[model samples]
Target: MKRIPDEVLDHIVEICNDEAALVVLSCASKRLRSRVACRQEAWRKRFERQFLQSNDSEQKWLHQHMRAKRAATHLGDTTSILLFPQGSAQFDWFDAYCERRAVEYRWRHGKYAAHRLTNTANVRPRGVRLQSILCAFDYSPAGDVAVVSQWLIASPRQSAWFSEPLYWGDMDTEDVVVLSKRQSDEYLVIQAWNMLVDCYSLCVWHTAAPHRPPRTIITDKREIPDVSLRGSWLAHRIAHSADTGQYGAAFVYDLARGACYSDIQGNIHTCCSLNATTDRMRIVCVEYNKSTSSPVTIAYKLWQVAPDRAEPMQCQATGRKAMSLKQGDIKLQRIDDGKFILYSRETDDLDPISAPTISLVEVVDEASGVLLKEKWSLGIRVMDIRSIASHDLFSIQQTYDKWLLLSLIDGSEVRRVHFNCWICSGLYPPDDQWAKMIDDSMWWNPRDDPTLHIHEEASQELSPAAIVYGHDDAITVVDYTGCMHRSEHQQGVERLSIEIRNRRIAERKHLVAEDKRIAAKRKLLLPEGVRMRTEGAHLRDKSKRMREEGEHIFTESMRMRDEDSRVYDKGKRMFTESMQMRDEGRRLCDEGRRILDECEHLTAKLQEIRAQIRALDST
Candidate 1:
């Protein structure tokens, strides 16, 4: 294996069946070790094959991974980080691959640290699980997001965050989180529901700079539900013409130049579903043909939207139609630049054989509106299609009890997790659900809306908490990013959990005492001769039982509180130590970042100098 040429070796490593064989091969010789494990090309291929692509700089992420391994050593979980012997460097590509692989496994297994939502103008999240999710708005697959019980907006592989500020506290359930296709993670459209106008006012926010105010993009008097923002262009639903009764679909506009490419008021208007895919879009249209009985048809057309000046919107049909849905649900989302994936169920209700089908189609024949590339995922009771990331791997709420990760690659359910709410699968219930169960009424402003199940199907179970957990509603923002920034906060979750138990016990005691007093007063009111001796003895026995129960509860509360105190003291000491170490880590990380930046600058400078030297040599 070591004697093979580098070109042959690269091919061998890329085509190697699995990582285990590669690890064993890497141990065979120093050449194998360098080529298979330490080299950039071999590891990059493995990284892409095994994990969700990260937008973070590979070098920076490598350093972060190194920091995590060091942290795990500090926390005494030394065995897991020791992937290889002395061979793994601080920022080796092999180590980077391993970290990403572990993170992916963390996502798959639903391993995460749950933190409650706090202010930044924020307190650290308390330890409790919040209610069920209404909707999740994800930025990337890296798990860097902000989740609210009202709505969920999550990302993956980074820290997740949500806020409860003055304005954002009012965003309604339908105003979804919209992320741009680019990796800057900037240019997300978050909406604020204005109840007075009964409309949603959408604003563009640079997600990284949350402390700054967002620039409002549109403020129409309607909640335009189907809005898509990609790169520099924005498309949404516009108001229809009142007099003509024509359909209305908002046109794309560039915010940088403040240019509107198409105006819907004067020209092209249609009741078509529109979603942006990079510089273009896949437009699906339905036409009702009068020639045949019950003749309804669906057609797919490519809609190319450019920032350059173009003629006003023109309504032109590519002139083809496909099968009409009798009763199930059909969803169309962008798979990439020119492709569209259609997920459909034959029946809305659950059936064993009639599973949801995913099709990758293009407008090859404008006549058929489909070039069928079928990938079928067989499942029952699919509640809704939540979000679809880049690789055609979509997340769906299966029976409203679990989030299943369905892949278009093999048309199978790759992973399913019951704990996390969304695609990133980072949000989870508190480590100790009862212990961390919180009363969040203080900040969680409740609204008197219609029923809880708004857009999706109503309750499958008749009870609310089964599908939509609304009791003790507090969210524990989970961190499965594994970047080593797990909060070593004090034992607030345990202490708070015990505190709630005590409150309930005290309330029970007060109610019992009040009932006894009422009974005694009523007996006195009945004349002294009317009171039976047997009745008096029975009342005495009941009072004694009540007293005994009260004493037991009091004793339990005392023991729990004592335990809570000891836990608090121990947690405080550990927390203090962890915080100190965390500071030291941050200081080191900042220095490392500076060095990396300098190295990048120097490398670029060296390249420029070499180019100049070549030019002089030519002269």
Candidate 2:
């Protein structure tokens, strides 16, 4: 065994592909143990084979595996005590990967229940309409503590319809938005517009004491005031009305210290848009300026707002630049670093012979101030976008039709889910027609026609364990807890597969114990063949019986291995078929999109021709 070549040992290890089998083989000799322990590549290969496929990048696969492992290790034995059990950390990252996929799949295909908040057919005297979902939080999977808000009500009370209300002060306001942090749950900030007073106020309340009066800041209403929060730092943009004209200013407030930096403003000139990093340490501000002479060429100013590293109290602005934007409603967002900000703007077709288009997204590097990523979406309407800071994942709501969870790492869509309303409509031509009608009409804008109110869904970190979304009156929770709620056929198949794996493991352990017992018995009760002179016949009988029993156990073990192999092969075939089906479905979706684009073109042409005929007749 010591003389065995490394190549031969490597081949054996690769073929076994099982950590338990490799461990047993390593114990056979010190040389083998050393080879296994020293070879990091072997462990990497084993990890990939257990969790990822050949097409997956080895680096990404390793990174994901390590991340999952770290998440499990930190949770410890309490992992199993949660509402959604993540299994034991010792079970390897394959278990974690399975759990992750289950969660994604549940969100992709799960059904949602909608609870209407207002009467669509009849208008009440109050004219209450669910304007927007400001912020949502779900801290527990057991549905213990939940907090969600529409433009009207922002509360922590868990009520189904519109029964219970904790904080209803914002309900009477025109526009309300909430910004809060999960890492620090002490502060809850609510910004609401009071039309009667013609003023906007920022109300900061301690979550522990909901009934208490909050610290407030009152100012005139602004057009697009943005608020961002991280840790104990809160940054916001205020639109202040003055004697000359309307202008905007950015401010930062330390909720912990109760220090407002409104007086010490330095370089932040204008505020068309404002975005901050997750740490709230960095802020990127977008300011648009039009020259008195050149109205056509509007310049944009991008400023990097950072806190003094040495002195946390002092804020400084270093990077400043200007660029010209041709057309669009430009929006800037600070993603992870000051070097890159998510640049999103909307552009419509210049010619009326085409359908109006929106939703163009890009990532711009501030060093050169150049757009790095090409426009991501064309001819797609986007309602909202949210980013998962830790995972580099972007969740997008595309035209109230579907939700796409996209990855910035690979620019690949991680998951796509059609809206439950559209799904219920069978996702057919009628649904497409209805979606187009909604897009063209002013139905979505409650301000235009409140009776035709439609609910919108956006991504929120409702809980540490779940990605929660709200639409209409219902709150949708996305997590692995829904895996047990699968169809009957799927549940049965999963149960059978688990049973096979458990049986194989149990049989292997039993066979090893039996072999050890037989060896011990032979050593105690039997003598060598040369020493057995008078009792040779009796010894032969005992030896033959022992050999037969050992053979029986070996045969049973081999049969079990073969059965397990067959089950694996069958599963592999099924997985291949599923992949093929998914590919086919994607192709169909692409084809449908193309057809819809052509139909829109034709409709626009027809409308143009009708207008021309009407003009000719009038002449």
Residue-pair clashes per prediction, in order, are: 13, 1
The TM-score between candidate 1 and the true structure equals 0.45
Strongest candidate by lDDT: 1
Residue by residue across 249-354, what tens digits does model 2's lDDT show? 6777767666665532332333322334432344444454433221122223343334433444333332332222333433554434322333333232233332
List, residue by residue over 1-619, the lDDT tens digit for candidate 1: 5468977877787778567678778778867776676456667665554433321222223434555455445445545343334456333567566555555445433344444433322332332222212222322211223323211122221233444332343344343333322212235565445444455566655533433455676766544544665544566556555556665555565655566654443212232334443444334432333243322244433444444327434443343334323344345665543335554433355444433344545334346443433333353444456434333455666554556676656657754333332233322222223134333211110111122212232211100111221112233333445432222222344355468768877887999999999899977876763556667888999999999999999999999999999999999999999999999999999999999999999999999999999999999
C-alpha RMSD for every candidate: 46.0, 35.3
The lDDT for every candidate, in the order shown, is 0.46, 0.44
Candidate 1: stretches off by over 4 Å: 1-17, 21-38, 49-96, 122-184, 239-246, 263-295, 309-319, 326-330, 342-360, 363-475, 483-619
TM-score, each model? 0.45, 0.40
Tell me the lDDT of model 1 at 295: 20
